[model samples]
Target: MHEVASQLSADLLGSGGLDRDSGLRPGAARQEVAQRFASVVADIASGAVQFPLPGSGGTSQRFAALRAVAQRDLCLARLVEGHVDATAILAELQEPSPGPTERWGVWAAEPPGEGVTATRTEAGWRLEGLKQYCSGAHSCSRALITATAEDGRRLFAVRTDGPGCEPVPGTWQAIGMAGSDSPDVRITDLPAVPVGGVEAYIRRPGFQHGGIGVAACWYGGALAVTEPLRSAAQRRPDPHTDAHLGAVDMQLHAAGALLDRAAAEIDQDPHDNSGSARLRSLRVRAFIEEVCSATLCHVSRATGAGPLCRDLRHARNVADLSVYIRQHHAEHNLAELGGLVARPENTR
Candidate 1:
């Protein structure tokens, strides 16, 4: 936990700190983030970072514990954009992934177009066409790409350093998460290795589980940005600022409580391959999203634009949270939650 915290602070709160235009060009910024990832990979590879898999313990206690750590170190996640999501995907794959030195990206975005495809080659599997939202494109050494195969959608792990792979420039345009470098990746028959069969990526209980972990990252970012407001309220004597601080504090407190409950539930039924994990993940993500949104608004209102203009770390965190929380699917997710709630299965 301490090592992860060190890596996070080193990457995000570096010498000069980050700004809106920090990683727009993708040169020095790319190398800086890659170094940070290398540090994390070193920890994971050396077994310093121990994350419990399904059924690691008698119950599922370790999974929830690791998740708590994820939430605490979310500032690093915010710093590097969504690279941690890809890392989580790699760690959670059915097949044992490569060593920690080999970074990974989760490239599963399918827009209205010819998504990535998997082709059988004499040597092995090959990935063709384009994959969208390839975060950590330049930095990550490998990627787990979802592509259409003969039967249905399957997950494929391809080495990003291969000849046929390319990270398209001028594609990523988000000012808030520019450091992520999530541009389009062009794959021209890059040799690939299949991780699992059709729909295995989406069908796994860990998929839903991972979504909540992402919400934790967002919650962490919100916490970082809202810290200034709390400090102001503590030192100042303004009723208006105090009121906003009180409201945001209540929100974060409620979200923290919910996160704790979700962690406990996850530990109780560690190996719930059933759809029950969906409910817990949806509730956590949605509630945290609400709390984070409220935090951003209240902090902005209470502090005005002075901190945003002067304080680089706080401003960057606020912008990053704004862009990062959009991972929430909004109505579609809510509708899914409603459907899950309607299903009266395993009633406790």
Candidate 2:
């Protein structure tokens, strides 16, 4: 899978596919990025690429693949990560795997707004209302979405091409990660298959592992953004530029080491028998988020605005990373981590 990511990155660069001047508009880029992601999904579906399942003892390899893709293009990585995560979720729930060539996404974002609601029907479950941040809205043939039920939150598997499923246009409007194609989707009476019991999605151990996977993508984006600074220091060898490079190197080194440790921990305790998965994820994600933020600052300060103004790829990377890392939930997640640590037993 890691090799596949490297090959995909090479293909994109060789074709000049992700360059802004590659004759693709923002909307066009969104479509193209989805296509790129689908092709990789096909690779995974086939025996061509073996995407490691979370907690399969190859968690580090899985994260490395995610990081590799993200290093090339964050938008593409976002879609790919969702697809893989959907597969992992299905496995953890003992659900049937998706058919080969079927593109999947996990849409469970619940902001302070109306979200999709599930009503139990004689035939099955029906979903209605609006789902925000539906990434791969235009591309995914299937999705594992969360909806509010009378009892509580539940996970549902719905075919995106089914009736009553509509992707609202003009809903996603951001320069950064625009190619992710995340928009508000409105569903009206869409039939869905319940994946697991209420709250099962979040309660599962893989949930924390998946969070670390996202941080891997962010770490990769940091690496991509750090390139400009690295190149500048190499060319001019200025003391200030070199200093920034050293700082970035140290931050990245720490982040990578933490990811390695987290992956190993997940492999050792796939079921979270130690009850520390959440804590591990919280610590790793928060640390990586800070590393990514600091990297952006250092790289920007060292390279100045020349790359942002002149290089389309670098500009897109910076913008996409800025938006992508926001998924960390800032202080809200930190507070949760704090609460967890404040436990009397946890402190010891």
Q: In order, what is each prediction's RMSD in angstroms?
A: 3.7, 1.7
lDDT of 2 by residue, 1-348 (tens): 244456455764334337554324678878788878878888888755556898898898899888888897899899999999999999999999989979999999999888989999898899999999999999999999999999999999999976788899899988899889899999999999999899999999999999999999999899999988999988887999999999999999999889888989999999999999999999999999999999999998888999999878888889999999999999999999999999997997
Candidate 1 residue spans exceeding 4 A from truth:
1-27, 54-94, 345-348
> What is candidate 1's TM-score against the reference?
0.85
The residue-by-residue lDDT of candidate 1 on 53-121, one tens digit each, is: 432331123333333333333323532323344545556564665575777667877878768888787
Error of 1 at 144 (Å): 0.8
Best by TM-score: 2
lDDT of 1: 0.68
Q: What would the TM-score be for candidate 2 when compared with the true structure?
A: 0.96
Per-model TM against the reference: 0.85, 0.96
**Lowest lDDT block of 10, candidate 2:** 14-23
Q: How many clashes (backbone N, Cα, C below 3 Å) per candidate?
A: 0, 0
List the global CA lDDT of all models.
0.68, 0.89
